[model samples]
Target: MLNFLKKNIALAWAKRHVSQTENFKNNAEKLQEELLLSLVKTAEKTLFGRSHQFEDIKTIKEFQDKVKINDYEDLKPYIEKVKRGQRSILWPETPEYFAKTSGTTSGSKYIPISKEGMPFQVKGAQSALFHYIAKKNNADFVNGKMIFLQGSPELEEVFGIKTGRLSGIVAHHIPNYLQKNRLPSWETNLIEDWETKVDKIVEETEHENMTLISGIPPWLVMYFEKLTEKHSKKIKQLFPNLQLIVTGGVNYEPYKDKMEFLLGGKVDIVQTFPASEGFFAFQDDYTKDGLLLLTNHGIFYEFIPLEQYGKPDTERLTLKDVELNKDYALILTTNSGLWAYSIGDVVRFTDKNPHRILVSGRTKHFTSAFGEHVIAFEVEEALKSTVLKYPAKITEFHLAPRVNAESELPYHEWFIEFEEEPANLNLFKEELDFQLRNRNSYYDDLISGNILQQLKISKLRKNAFNEYAKSQGKLGGQNKIPRLANDRKLADLLEIYKL
Candidate 1:
């Protein structure tokens, strides 16, 4: 009776959120325009706002003209001030928590999550599940145990501000009502070692009625693998009621086949576009390929064409200005006091009416060693196509250029961990090469001119990616292995470059 009531309550709320979703969909441009002004007005008294003359900015154009698009480095000084207990430095009030995240070159980064902005983050996540429930007209999963593989929940205080991994911080926000149905236990979740944590989680959840699982794809994959290996049975045999999957941080296409195989059946996947900075999008329809961008959230967004990015006169585009199928660098100004911040993600619009999008790749994460400029989307799509014919399940894969004279011609090298190897290895390589060339014209040109050889595959041993990640202290909880690298740093570290 309690489960029935909970499910009904969820459905009712989902119904109401539909209208709210519709309003934002139809009036995205208007909503965004209002939000930009509102954010400007709200933060005008803050140090950053005052410095940028936000009070005088009445229009989006005026705001853009007054404030330049900034990366983390540009805002580091202000972020430092906030870290030292300065109030009204970036936002008007002190942050409720600082989401600490790993950076490639900057090392540890502490991103502020304001008290005012935190609820919207929680809302975006709720709406994702709510939207799924409303569309499917089924909330069976609501009553069952749900697990979110994440960073250790134990937090450390830094100068009066609680600081921890973004996932760890979010873990603390799970509602009291749902606490009974969430796992693993608090004591187990506090284990800092991901390997031990995952093993403990496997023991705890192996026999539970788990209906929903949430985490980044790679970590979730590890959990599934461990569970199946321990019981010597597929996931469906263990958790027959499992219905939905929630994931973010990386593209899912490359892992779809492997994930589904591990599940032992097809399941609805909810892909969310979330970052330490903010929640941007979530999959609203199971049938659709793209995530619906949230316009009504406390964020005002801007986009710069991928080709025009980093230029002196590059134009910043709003929701109304974006075109379908064009790759753009996503920029955000949020209620949490991020002003015209470039989060380094590249996205492509799949639909224009309601602004549905796909995360194309990262602006800084691509391989252009031979001027091919191969992006993650292209590589993932190519691999997807090739795998259809080759019939291989990939655990993980990475691409880097091989340019040494000792090895022969310059070429792209793929280090792949496969659960199921292809029947014909040479034919598999040929198919992959063909698929990539079909997607990237520059790569095709290079191959045709004999400037580069066809991409080579170095089949990696099982748990190769996990070992590499563990070595870097990023074995779990939202850490994604970069799909494309311009240099051989990753390849050299993993020792996969030696042919």
Candidate 2:
């Protein structure tokens, strides 16, 4: 009864929050200006501010003209100073801690998390849940335990500032009042070995009233498999109250059917766009076509057209200026003192009034070796359609272009680890190639002109991806496999397991 009452109160608060968010959305342009002014005023006293002459910035146009778009490489020097315990380098005071993430091209990164910015990160996630509950009217889900499968909360001092994976940092700071409703225990969560930690989580939550589960889809699939194995029944049978599955980190379309089958029953699926930089967007409507951007959050957003991305003196557009269905690389100026920082993700606007968007792909994750430019969104769509048409299930896969100097044509090389192998592998390959060609006009043109050969598929040993991730020290918790690579680096890595 107490838990029910608590859920009702929380639901009421969430509804109110959503109502306020709607107001902000309606007046987004005004809110955005206010947010920009506040950020500029606050950051004007920091070292970066003094160097960039933030005091001279009184308008949005001035702010943009003064600050250039920056990648991680540009901030490394300032971040190094912060790492050495320097005060007022970026933020007004020293950062409370740094959130570490595995870089796509570089080794690793330490993103500063200031005291003021921490709440924004936390609020972004909470707002997502609030929007979910408001849309579905499923407050009862909060009556049971919510298991967020994430990394260990253990922290290491990086030159006096505490640092760890962003999820770990967030997990460590979950609100005290709500701590009892979450799992696994701090001790269980701190276990470094993923297999062991999952075992502990299964043991702890197997008998509990688990209403909601949130994690990357692959990890959740692994956990659900273990639960079903232990109980000799599906997840729906073990946890009768399970209501929702929230996932992010990787595209879920490829894993949707497999996850639903493991669950034993249909459940609400919420997609989120969270990264080490910030919690950006979440599924707001039941259709799930796109995520509604959190406008009133402590972040200002800009978009650079994908075609103009690397060019000198490229134009940047704000939310008011973006057009629907055009891909743009996302840039953020946050209250955390990151000014005009490119977050490396690309997105396309789907709705103008509400400012909803679909994540297209990473800025660096595309292939155009033979004029057949392919993005992750197209690849995922093609794979999803092909899988539905076939009888196979994929455990993991990677796509890369294979160029043979001696050969007249280069071809796409696909490394696939299958959960259920197709009865006719050749037919499966043909259908996949057909789907890709249909989805990407450039690919179709190239194939018709004989500029590129049909894609080649190589079967991989079971757990090939897991083994590869382990070798790279990114076995679990928010780390993801790059689905598309421009070169043969990933292909060469998977070659060892080819059958």
Candidate 3:
């Protein structure tokens, strides 16, 4: 009964606060204080356990004063220690689950999130739906089967027990309060699990009354392309109730047009920021970006300047110190027992107090091919702008930088697949190249023969991403082709069919 009352009180507080954006903004100081108080409790449990690491209030103040910034790489060993049931200088208790990342850039990163931490992630996702419904003035559509296209559900056993990947693990923990009888099953793969079920997992949603679809942008885009090719006319004949699509994990620019084509019209779309570690944020309204902060119900936050990310001299700042439009690397001390932990994402504040943010990119996910210094968001924007000039027929594209042996500079290469041929293909590529070079100074210098050579375009095979994903042992779920490759090794493989 006490737990229920506590949950209700928190929910009521959230409802009251979120309903008034102005209130949230104005009360930023109070919110920061409250967040710090809660964080101190979490920190005390972890850092100053029964033996009392802090010992006195003065030491606690000193600890806060001297807090250091950290990254996921820094937290891995601590997480492992906690997983083994050892109390660390941070977490007072052991973590319950280890969530697995997509492993898109490198090997998968496993994040330890506790049962207490899970509620925040789940509530944040659901609140986005509420926000969407409020925006649409259609609260009636809140209950339905939300098709989540995630990884295969194969659990690798550790210590003689069975456990699935992060997505699967989270799905298994979904509370009964939010579930519907008709909820969309995790259909990426059910058998053979993660390691081997790539081919066996099917992409058919023919019979399901899918009301909302959520997954990584790439797999969703590929799935929509296949739907248009195989069951274009018969879509209404299959899932007649399909309504909204929620996508994240990667950029959405390339697949926006193709997705609408398959849906037969512009279906309402919501983007989200859910890592294997947590469901961080969501595009509450049909906005171009997202509204975000830590769930008030769970995690606590600290910030460090973006420029200070890899530097050893970086000092951590509390929420009180943050400024709007400035980039900050996040330091999280969570209910799950992670302290001063950096999740590796770089973000900037979009609004103050009410606390909305936009994820810029990972600190490492950049293209400096010949000093171009192109970030992921820049590349996504360039492609989005280029696609706007073309007919709505173009579906998807991927960009990479290729180094030529004969030329002095590296070139920007694009692989595009369209629904129909453009009126003038050469004009399209030329304009795209011009715009990209003009928008980014680095690219312009390259084009001026000061640095890099030229830009190239490639026409991918129809459903090239699908075939590529299949070849990589991926099912039609959240995983998709990378939009930008930062280095020469990955870029060479992407330049095969130059247009």
Model 2 Cα shift for residue 438 (angstroms): 2.9
lDDT of 1 by residue, 1-499 (tens): 9889999998998878876789898899998999889888888899999999988999999998999999888888999999999999889998888888888877788888899878877788899988998999888998999998888878899889999988788888897867889999999889988889999999999999999999888888889999998999999889999999999888888888878888998678999998988989999877888999998888899999998899987999999999998889999998888889999999999987878999999998899999998898999999898888989888888899999847588999899888888999899999999999999899999999999998898988877888889888877765788988999889887674223
When sorted by TM-score, best at the front, the candidate numbers are 1, 2, 3
Rank ordering of all candidates by lDDT, starting from the highest: 1, 2, 3
Comparing candidate 1 with candidate 3, which one achieves the higher TM-score?
1
lDDT by residue (tens digit), candidate 2, 1-499: 8978887887898889888887877888778888988898898888899988989998889999889999988888888899998888887878877998878665688898888888877888788888888777768887789899999899999888889988899986787756878988989989988888899999999999999899998899889989998889988999989998888877777888789888898688889888777788888887857888887778899999988998989988988899999889999988777889999888999998888888888888887778677888888888888887887888888999988746468888889999898888898899989999998899999899988888989999988998999888777766788888788888898899887
Question: What TM-score, computed on C-alpha atoms, does each candidate reach?
Answer: 0.97, 0.96, 0.81
Once model 1 is optimally superposed onto the true structure by TM-score, how far is the C-alpha of residue 461 displaced, in angstroms? 1.7
Candidate 2 RMSD to the correct structure:
1.8
On lDDT, the stronger of 2 and 3 is 2
Roughly what TM-score does model 3 have, to 2 decimal places? 0.81
Model 2 poorest ten-residue lDDT run: 402-411
How far off is residue 344 in model 3, in Å? 2.7
